[model samples]
Target: MNDEKEPQANPWMKSLLIWVGILLALVLFVSMFDSSSRQPDGTSIAYSEFLARVDEGTVKSAEIAGNVVSGKLTNDQSFKTYAPSDPQLVDRLTAKGVEFRAKPEEQASFWMILVYQSLPFLLILGIAFFVMRQMQKNAGSGAMGFGKSRAKMLTEKQGRVTFDDVAGIDEAREELEEIVQFLKDPSRFARLGGKIPKGALLVGSPGTGKTLLARAIAGEANVPFFTISGSDFVEMFVGVGASRVRDMFEQAKKNAPCIVFIDEIDAVGRHRGAGLGNGNDEREQTLNQLLVEMDGFDANEGIIIVAATNRPDVLDPALLRPGRFDRQVIVPKPDIEGREKILAVHMKKTPLAPDVNARVIARGTPGFSGADLANLVNEAALLAARKGKRLVAMSEFEEAKDKVMMGAERRSMIMTEDEKKATAYHEAGHALVSLYIPGCDPLHKVTIIPRGRALGVTWNLPDRDRYSMTMKQMKARLSLCFGGRIAEQLIYGADELNTGASNDIQQATDMARSMVMEYGMSEKLGWLRYRDNQDEVFLGHSVSRAQNMSEETARLIDSEVRRLVEEGEARAREVLTDNLDELHRLAGALLEYETLSGDESKRVIKGESIGRDDAAGRRAAQMDTAGSSIPKSRRPGGGWDAAPQGA
Candidate 1:
């Protein structure tokens, strides 16, 4: 059943075979019809018959063409014969009164002779031309582009972005100011017997101005900046990446005192040999070349390499060693004052009303980065424009902020009265629990409006950014997350509890599981964190099937997670039981207005104006003290700090 068709021959081969066949056929026909072969039936009276026919006047017509003579007999018989060099051949033909003609010797056509003579030379020349063109085309990109560096050079003319242009990362800027000084006055450091560090790395979460700080360094140093992505160092070709690495360093050497910045450096700088999967040979070669270049270059050469990546944990240790990226500057999310500064910087582009204070906006955006602030300002301006307002007012900014956090108001998403009441109660329950919990984030806003995939949203914005979280706050958050489901069970009974709190339960379950497995919060696990050692360099997830524990440990982990969730639910129930009247009041307010701000929520819950948040308690975070509720297993030397102690 082999139905495969045989492969066909090349068209040129087929055409050449046909031409050869035609030539052979012509040769065979010429051999078969050669004038030297006498016909089988013809009489062999060559010279005598020719003389007799010429004398008898039977040769009616004759022609002498070069060597062979052809004539027609009077009886209409044709024959071809050669003529000897007879001086009176023409006179003899005239005497016999026979019609005869002699053809002049034919000369070869000029163009035909030229073609036959030059064909070989023409073929050779055409082949050479085609081959040379193909070679040049390949050299242009197939070979040449592989060896050229892809870095873009930004000189003083293109980049004027100094440290002033960046905000919300003051610590990083200060950390890099020395590098700037080193680049500007290398001799000063040299005279002091201090060698400038060859490299610095910027690491942080996305949108935290990591790349911006690198540009700011180049601007402040007033040096040529070579900008490229870590990916630009890699190519599909085997040796191209290594060649590019050499090329880039050579260019940087030509422009001494320049700064080279590779943004998103994890693309080529992942840990070697044993992290996520088997290492890539091409990528490894490029990395090796980079290592060689870094070692070969002198620290006093005044060229600095600054790279940025969000995944510093996955970078190779060899890259971060001393004399390489010796300095690691952290660019974190903005704090209250930093957010305020960033907003003011972005607000300079837009006309704003006096009532729209940047500080107020900063207080509301605790974890916002400089980029987020810029986006927020843009959204506010867009809202103002949509309303044809001359200036972006406080109301517009507030609406935009609300829209950013909870998503755009879905007024068109119609709901029955019962569904509305259920959503209202659910949101109010979250706000109410957070209000009573001492370590919980301050309850900011609650709304029953549908946004994204949620039926309602409850915002709990901290007054400031936090670096860590404590066990007490985590447990409080777990209770706070499940408060909606608890509320539904309390008001509508277990049978009537809908799927609105399904997302809440799932979140609570995952948090509890993380506390047990990754955070070492379980007593039975005994400070043993069951987390994968694998790290993904490119932000993709990695799963390592390297569990060392037995099935019993897994079951215990599941049991512990369930206990945490149940305990949190019981706590929520107790809190709601004691303040049923307040919960009802909050739910009622939500039903009427469909939204409640921090002040309104506080008034509904505590019957008082919104006062200062628990900053005093927050600043005195007792991570190691007995006052902390985190399990000792979870708290390694001490507990995790839930907040920036004095920040």
Candidate 2:
């Protein structure tokens, strides 16, 4: 995708040319001095033939040096030959009236001798220089540029992203708009004697559009934007990182009113004293330099430093204090309305079918970040294109959402009839239990089709965005988690239960323990929290990972967790036992259809048909009106092999 041309002076090709030139010079030097093996451009003959030519009176002239002979015949032809050590050869040549002389050996000049003597040393030095230059380039600094900053200045021509491109984080966008305004008209704030914020720290989970927001700020202000990763500042050398930090601030001062964004700042800004290493550690030194640069004696008036980190808890306190990072912008995951806005932004570039609804998709995706929504839109588009459709449809969006939330369907995995039936019953139990539970989420889907690592999945969709859980909801969730195992135990006997409930058991245990210890829901625990502090032990803090409670307290906590899980299991077993016929009906529907939507599942539990025969009739009508070219199951939600659904 990079259209830029390669540099003309390719290092690989340059090294090859250097070696070739050296070899050519060496060959030329050796050829100049060695005259014994040198041959003249003439016909070759034996030594006796040269003498015979002289005797026959055909010799005009001859030359000899180091046992090599060259001569011209009277007929004006040239000849050369190698001669043995013969004492009479010179006398014979003289007696035959053939003019002959001993030619001197060629010798190299002073410059050539000097070059030849120093060739190896020169080659070694050249290789060393080339290696050093490559190393410097890899370090992102040229030779003697070890202290130079690696921040790249982003320009408008490099795919400019304005405020219009950023969505879902409206509050964050509004917060940063003032900074952009300050950059455009600094006099506005200056006249009021109010200084613009020196820095802003964007705190958020991953994929929350923090970096995108930074770029949008630069685009809106129309000022220079210098961006670099925090890791780029640190190097193996202790002082290199600090030197780079100083150099970066110096560049920012030159480009006043520009935004300097350091992404993943936690890399260099982790708490210094918490590490095992001494104060001279490279990362700690870099953090120290950054602290001074942000809020030091020298006022960096127009330079605004914007940094992003997911782990703000681990950052150095000095870096996050006021005057350094004046504003801490929280870029949380988008809610329903925010998700709709984000989807609308991404959908602008995509060709959508009339049925495609952004609000519905947003509502379906409860906790999707802006990036997740964008990927969802992209995945929907990909699915439509894969199906040879010109525009993305609602069904494609639904399928794409399922893929993003759960995982891709593994229809290629072979399953026996009994396995499929067991999985259907297992998923049916979850769906049925959720429907009957008082505070449980709405049953969105139940499927026997394998997705991700699960043999079957029962999905629940919240009617509204939930920020916290209530006690009733927690108890209902525990029962829902145990539903699958309980159903298996009842139908196939307790001893024959499969390992499909392993994840469910683990989740149930964690939630119950969290309730008893962290949430303080256990009446016997007397509202006291029993959770342990989790620290970064690898960073040399909190070396001991042992529990904070006594053995008796630990035993009590375990018993409480087990009691909650058992109560949940008992509740699920009671519900399933009472509605045994309904469970069978739902499981049978799942086995027949392979997947069911929320409404269809409700219908099946109520002892009603899901009207699949009517859908088949519609497909048959389509086949009759059109031709046999279209496959029966090619559409997203058509035919026998329909994709799984969510609320």
Candidate 3:
């Protein structure tokens, strides 16, 4: 896609050349009018000489008619005298230091007159050439841009991404297809009493193909597509944004039956009253104009508007109301099938091993979007190249997937023996806790080997996709998060707990807060959202409002969260304590294998009492628990505890 502005010539130099040419033409015209007439008596005097002779009085009453100077001269004794050559008169004039000369009128070349007249033209031409060279030197590439909009127009050939190029956004594509149809055949829809939708807004997270879908719409429509970012309308100058908006709409109207795609529309379409600075007013003005252009009474027909934004929540309500942006399509991360399709699309150019399965890759990358899949394919190709391989193997794809999803594997990373041991136990603690938590998903793999920025990773794969989360499931997950810290404290005492659980602590705390304040999971809080005062911004503000709860209630909330963590920790410590020997054995095995499969992990968790196959089967059976296996009382304790401290 050609999203960049086109190269331009120097404006000042071009203007200078034009002005110089005009000046030269005027100078040449004035010089051409200086023609001389010949006197009747056969001798011709130059126009300048004629004027001088009239002033000098060398011949009285002289009539210089045509090419001849025929006039009677006052003499000592003479009535009329005419001489073609006056040798004595010439000698007398020469003595007086006056020079008189005559030449044939034909000798005065028009070309010579033109050359003299064009002096200014020649100077200007030289100046214009010099100025052009100087402008080129200083202007670089972009200089003739005073009025032109810096929008890149991507034709179908340049943007090869059709609907087929996009993956993981099936619903969004289906919604957009209606717009495409309307553009291709508006009469069909109009015959059914359906007015073509003026605009469609694509909302999603970054890398979710919002912008890509817009391009696809343009390509599918097969019309002139004008693309500019929302930020392009906004400028420091007041009314600039509004003017750009007007100009953009005008351009779109001229190219009627075309698509206008704006990426990141939030730049100008933000809520009017939400911004903090002067620029907000201008942006709001631009947004208002856009709303009018999209749905105004006189708005042009067959002109479709497509805008993509990650933060649709922050957009002006007026902009999203019925007529302006009637349809909002959400392009979310691809599901398993979508992921598989996306992977296939990306891997078309990559040479994959025979064993490489798009389904397997898709299944593994649950949250990956189309862009991420493309990146993954490219990364795999690069990895294969780095390894001096002719084709990207399944293993290479796996490595690339891991690298993109999680950071690069730190195989040669230096860690002390104590650190390594701590990491192993910490990871084991997580796996063990998850194993015991009934509602927690089944373990996928556990590795103490450094990967990305982590010293270890414990991956849990959900049995199926889940869109909603229940309180019980949330609490179980929170408990699992605290398990690593708990195991560290139990085995290595207080000194064992480290920053390894920083992310875990944060995640667990947020969940607990949401449970108490937002979810109303607490007995006292009821179903009300305690923190209902929104920050006026989308998704709430970065900073929270002042605490509304009393000091006592605050303390209680803190105690509840702590109780939840401690309970989970205590459970982890107990599980590890019971399987202490197994934990050590597994840790030793991990050092050798660098990773452990779900079956191997289950075997280690079950200890020597069960065989590997039996352990796997038993673990699978345990996973069938309805919700969570932990008893209500023993459930990773954290909510408000009314009982006294040690009770």
* Leading candidate by TM-score: 2
The CA-based lDDT of model 1 is what? 0.75
Worst 10 residues of 3 by lDDT: 638-647
Rank order (by lDDT, best first): 2, 1, 3
Tens digit of per-residue lDDT, candidate 3, span 1-647: 23333233445666667777777767655655544332244344454554455456554444322244444333412122234444455455455454345444355578776776676677778677766665555421235322235455677557556888887788888888988888888889989899977888988888988888888888888887888888888766667677667777777777878888899999888888776765447777778778888888786788888898998878889989898888898888888888888888888888888989888878777777778888999999999999999888888888887788667888898888667666765776777777777778788777877776787888887766668788768777877786666655644554333456777777778788877777777776567665755554346656556347788877777776676666655665567667654555565555545678778877655553234233433443342244423222332333211100000
Instruction: List ranges where model 3 is wrong by over 4 Å.
Output: 1-147, 277-280, 533-541, 604-647
Per-prediction backbone clash count: 2, 0, 14
Best by lDDT: 2
What TM-score, computed on C-alpha atoms, does each candidate reach? 0.70, 0.83, 0.72
Predictions in order: lDDT? 0.75, 0.82, 0.69
Worst 10-residue lDDT window for candidate 1 reads 638-647
Clashes counted in candidate 3 amount to 14
lDDT of 3: 0.69
Writing each residue's lDDT as its tens digit, candidate 1 over 1-647 gives 13222223454565566557556655754554463353323323375578778988888888777656776788877776766787777898989898888778556578756755665575567556555554555432444366778888986656488888888788888889999999888888889799777889998998888888889898888889999999988877777888888888888989988998989888888878844434557788888888778875444376799999998988999999998888899898889888988888888889999899888898998777777788889999999999999999998888888787667877898788778777876787788888887778987888887876677888988867788888888899999987776665666554453455666777788799888887878888878778777643455766544368889888888899999998888788788778766766677667666777878787756544334343212222332245533223331121111100000
Question: How close to the true structure is residue 254 of candidate 2, measured as C-alpha lDDT?
Answer: 96
